[model samples]
Target: MSSTQKPVSSEDALGQKYDRCLADLLVKSGVGFGAGVVASVILFRRKTWPIALSTGFGAGAAYADCDRSFNPARIPGTRILPKAEAPASK
Candidate 1:
């Protein structure tokens, strides 16, 4: 590494992390759009592209934002801990 090269800071890394999140949002939104279209056609028995597109985009975007904000680590764990067992009587 050259002395002139600067070390990557957390701020710099955050941008790339957000970029990945945005990509994920876009891809998931696309999938949701398709799903919504199919659902509309199946349930409504007609072309409801507008509703489908809006619903899909809204749901996907909301989900992505919420997921990112609330569960950045994506760890599988419960907020509440298990209660300890009581002592057995003789």
Candidate 2:
């Protein structure tokens, strides 16, 4: 006989998906910051404040884009889970 397991609830699925997206955003932001700092240093060495400022703005824009794209629903309390309210055993 064939058997099929029930799929996860929508809430649980969405929570997992959002967690992954948040992690990806954080990693990307770190990379973006590092790239921005390197570019800014190069511009500074060239004695160009305008270029450095523009690079910084670009980095900010990238971060903003990630924030808005991944955080559309604004999941509340997704970042922290209290220890007292732990799930009980059946």
Candidate 3:
């Protein structure tokens, strides 16, 4: 190992994923809310359903991304490495 290289454990990797998921959730939901508000005001005549629908859509997308992050199999066209060739997370 080099002096500048730091070993990362599975726990650390999990934590990083969680942090990224949280950030994505917040950003996606916020953008959805903004879009919903704009649509509600201009197109829907201030209806509340558009706001909720848009926000839910954004949150759903974020959730899907978080799912893929934790479970690589959820991603399409990806094959699992053979156990012998896979790196040990520990």
Candidate 4:
């Protein structure tokens, strides 16, 4: 241990992670919701809640599973997005 360094407790680490995840969830969902509204308006030419909600959910899911096309686990909670897969060699 360094003289000026302090050990981080498990609880603190967990709290920090929780805060980050919550923030990510809120930001991603908000952006998705906004995009959905725009898309719905463009497609239907009217303000519709149902279509907007559906598209927002889809967009949020896409954001959570950014690495892959889709991930089922994303529906549960905000998750740290998975790492990108390495490109396959010929």
Candidate 5:
């Protein structure tokens, strides 16, 4: 018998990972920058550090998410159960 699915190459896997990381970085960093801008304008008297700080936080969060995606075992509250086996015939 033959399997129907195409085998995935290492390059394809790497490409997929890179795509995920890039998307996460863009989205997270954008949100963080927006938040920083708001905080800086409202609370910090238009300081530049808040924007930088929040952007860094967002980038860091993206890094954590990408790391978790690459290493699922690092995720919190995960459980791995054993498979069941059939009984032997007499």
Candidate 6:
């Protein structure tokens, strides 16, 4: 049995690269938020309200960073995928 390989077009390759970059940014941001939340809790327990607040701000900043990084403004001229394309199995 012979299997034919389908070549990826430049557009497809670019799309894949963009997707990977966006995904990595999101994952890292999520990790940052999680770590921030944990640290905030720890600081709160230690009676350090200022540190806890700062950690909470860090989480918010991480989320904003993710949004800004993935935003169309940051990646001009690239086609934005529809919401349906978000699922990995799709």
* Candidate 5 lDDT over residue span 36-66, tens digit each: 9999999999999999999999999999999
The C-alpha lDDT values of all candidates are 0.68, 0.63, 0.95, 0.64, 0.92, 0.64
- Ranking of candidates on TM-score, top first: 3, 5, 4, 1, 6, 2
Best by TM-score: 3
Candidate 3 lDDT over 2-34, as tens digits, reads: 578689999999999999999999999999999
lDDT tens digits, residue span 19-80, model 4: 66666667767776777677777876766874568656855664565533234454556566
Candidate 5 accuracy as lDDT: 0.92
Model 1, 1-90: lDDT tens per residue? 666977899887778777777776777777777777777777767667855685668667756675755565654563533466655559
Clashes of each: 0, 0, 0, 0, 0, 0
Instruction: Go through the candidates in order and give the C-alpha RMSD of each one to the true structure.
Output: 9.5, 10.4, 4.3, 9.8, 5.2, 11.8
Model 6 lDDT-worst window of ten: 46-55
Scored against the true structure, residue 70 in model 1 reaches a CA lDDT of: 54
- The C-alpha TM-scores of every prediction are 0.49, 0.44, 0.85, 0.52, 0.74, 0.48
Q: On residues 1-90, what C-alpha lDDT tens digit does candidate 2 reach at each position?
A: 889989999898878777866676566656665665676677556445545465556556655655655575544445544688767769
Say which prediction, candidate 1 or candidate 4, comes out ahead on TM-score.
4
Sort by lDDT, top down from the best: 3, 5, 1, 4, 6, 2
Native-to-model Cα distance after best TM-score fit, residue 46 in candidate 2, in Å? 9.8
lDDT of 6 at 34: 66
lDDT of prediction 1: 0.68
Query: Cα deviation in Å at residue 63, candidate 3?
Result: 0.5
Q: Any idea what lDDT model 6 has? A: 0.64
Top candidate on lDDT is 3
Question: How many clashing residue pairs, candidate 1?
Answer: 0
Model 3 bad stretches (over 4 Å)? 1-3, 84-90
